[model samples]
Target chain A: MYQDWIWGLVGGGLIGIAAALYLLVNGRILGASGILGGLVDGTERAHSKERLAFLAGLVLVPVSVVPFYSSVDTHLTPNLAVVIFAGLLVGVGTRLANGCTSGHGVCGISRLAPRGMVATVFYLLGGGASLLLFKHVLGVI
Target chain B: MRALFAFIAGGTFGTGLVVSGMTDTTKVQGWLDIFGDWDPTLAFVLGGAVVPMFFAWRYTDGRLPRLGGKFPAPPEPKLDHNLVLGSLIFGLGWGLAGLCPGPAIASLSYGGFGGGVFLIAMIAGMLAAPPARRWLDAVAGSS
Candidate 1:
């Protein structure tokens, strides 16, 4: 248990490092929704090969984790309706804001962008409040 | 180029999710289940992210790159009603759906029924934004 937490922290550190490096090296923000969105939006900011490669990396990275991190259990799947609804909502939110958690919370905040700061504050607060609403207020949990 | 960097960034982010056991739906569900059994893995994950994030922010400040022209910094959005409304909607969706963009696509790699639906709806949501914006603008114009 302790080890899992330690590993989790290390993993997160790796993510932050990669995000920084990506900005430094590729000059692109690491927002998952934006990357996925640009693929179909006909943005011309990215070509088909680039889109495919980006999406492929997302899929491939986790696939590679099966060997070392077999301890993970993925059984608690949400209902189809819930999954679809949630995805659509997040997709809309990402578009409206022009970035997702990674882009805003990680990259934007790092740069001290005022918008990122405000967005992240709300992001965290909203997340916490929602959890409270669902788990406590609604008694859904 | 941004394309290659996109891949590298996604790969790194995905790897982090996998290693942290965040790609597992069961794990996320467990953490969200506060009453049944308090799982603190989420805190650990946030903590992990914050530490390196601090250093990354410090070191990268006032830095420039030779190859990448310039950092593709995100333009700050104007703080107004739009920002708040957008965030509230986002929170509502996140609360209702345990799957966000990153986790949703990441889970697809492992194969799950929900992952497909999530992706489909996500795309639909993305597509709807253009028309929605137009509608909002028209309403504003009329008023």
Candidate 2:
């Protein structure tokens, strides 16, 4: 149990450091949504191939990992309409916010931006509040 | 170098989500169900994530990344109405969908139906925003 926790922490930290470094060194903000969106949009610049490669890596890495992790079955599925609506809403929010939780919560807050700090608070709080609303209020489960 | 590393790191992170079972929307929904008898697994997952975060932030003393380039920062610093509105919408969607960009990408690794739909809708939503923003701006200006 302790080791798993440790692994999780280490893994999460590696992710955060990797993201910050990616931004600082590569000049790309490590927002998952932004990167994914860019890949679908396609690019035709000097390093566009590299951009595509990076996006490919994101998809492929998980493909590679499946052997070890063993996919767990999650029994519930929300209606397609609900899922689609949610995805669209998140898309709008990521665009409006200029980043997702990763951009603001991990990278942005690390830089000590006031906005990032505030955003992180809201991100967690909103998530928490929504959990309450979904499970308790709406009886989503 | 930064771009290359960003790609690699993001991929690895995505892989972690896939391996960790976070890509399962059911699990995400399960995690959110605190009142339906909390699962407590996600908390541990988050707790696990936070541990290294502390160390990483501590160790990296704002050194310029070995990659010469840096991501562009947003032009402004103020938390206007846009920020609040966006956060609300994001949270609302997250609550409703049980998935977000990171997890969706991770789900893509598995090549499942939900992942496909989620990814498509996510991109559409992203693409639609600029036009939506333009419309909103025009409406505000006219009024």
Candidate 3:
């Protein structure tokens, strides 16, 4: 329905605003992967407190807001092996590349940075190819 | 105060992911499944997010740093094998699972067993990346 599109736009806009806020106030890029990565990888020790606080908010806000919004249907793949493989690829890939959708796609592209643009293009191409291979060639979904 | 702002920013970002249906694996997959029953909603979400962000970038240009913190240095524009290779690997995984880091974490509360599994695996993979990167670099250098 059109409502879904509207919500998507509004929600996306909010995400941009959040990124902007982080940039304006914190003077940092609002990259989900980098923030989380720094914590787990021991690379962001100096800013651990800030990272922890941001993650706490990221998790908590969603939990609180769930009561007001309709229950979200996640539709994650049911296969455990596939899920694990996918997770590993995403985790390793994002770190190796130094960004993900939020960091590279949204934040990177907005600034018109070449690295961000290049990453985004490659990932989308990769996603597209994977979809074709899995869905059409492999027929595994 | 810094933490508070970070918290607010994170909360807002999470809400946006949830509201935009970015947390839904099917929707994400749908966008990638362009040859199949493709859903256009994700495109709208991307478009909407980019508009304000575009302006944000422009505004920050040639301005003093705000909030008493140093602005991030512009990322080095070096094009390397790792960038392309990593992105390819990431894309394949994204298409397969339809859950990236942001939605994956945000959906944890509601995503049940599958979500837990994916998160644990992701963390493990992240922990492994440093060594992997080192090994990769070693191989590249040796060759």
* Candidate 3 reference-contact recovery: 0.80
Q: Give each candidate's fraction of reference contacts reproduced.
A: 0.55, 0.49, 0.80
TM-score result, candidate 1: 0.82
DockQ head-to-head 1 vs 2, winner:
1
Q: How close is candidate 3 to the true structure, as a TM-score?
A: 0.95
lDDT of 1 by residue, B1-143 (tens): 65666676677787887777666655655555554455677667656665565566566558765344665554846775445555555655665565567767776755466667778888898888667667766776888
State which candidate has the highest lDDT.
3
What's the lDDT for residue A12 in model 2?
A: 57
lDDT of 3 by residue, B1-143 (tens): 88999899889999999999888888888888877887888888888888888998888877744778576878999877678878888899999999989888888778989998998888887888888889888988999
What TM-score would every model get versus the actual structure?
0.82, 0.79, 0.95
Residue range B12-92, candidate 2, lDDT tens digits: 767556544456666566555555554545555554444444454444455544556433644478885456666667766
lDDT of 3 by residue, A11-88 (tens): 899899999888888888988888998899898897787788888888789878755445687899899998999999
The DockQ-based order of candidates, best leading, equals 3, 1, 2
Worst 10 residues of 2 chain B by lDDT: B47-56
After superposition, the stretches of candidate 1 with alpha carbons farther than 4 Å from their true spots are A1-4, A47-51, A66-71, A76-78, A135-141, B1-5, B29-40, B50-66, B136-143
DockQ of all candidate complexes: 0.53, 0.47, 0.78
| Residues A1-141 of candidate 2: C-alpha lDDT, one tens digit per residue | 454444445555555655645554565556676665565555325456556656767767766655654544433254677667778888877776666766666666656677766766665555556768766787653
Can you write out model 1's per-residue Cα lDDT over A1-141, one digit (the tens) per residue? Answer: 677678768766766766776666655566777778887676646445655666777777767754664555445345666667666777777777667666776676666777777876665555556567766788553
For model 2, the superposed segments whose C-alpha errors exceed 4 Å read A1-7, A38-48, A73-78, B1-4, B19-21, B34-36, B39-63, B70-75, B135-143
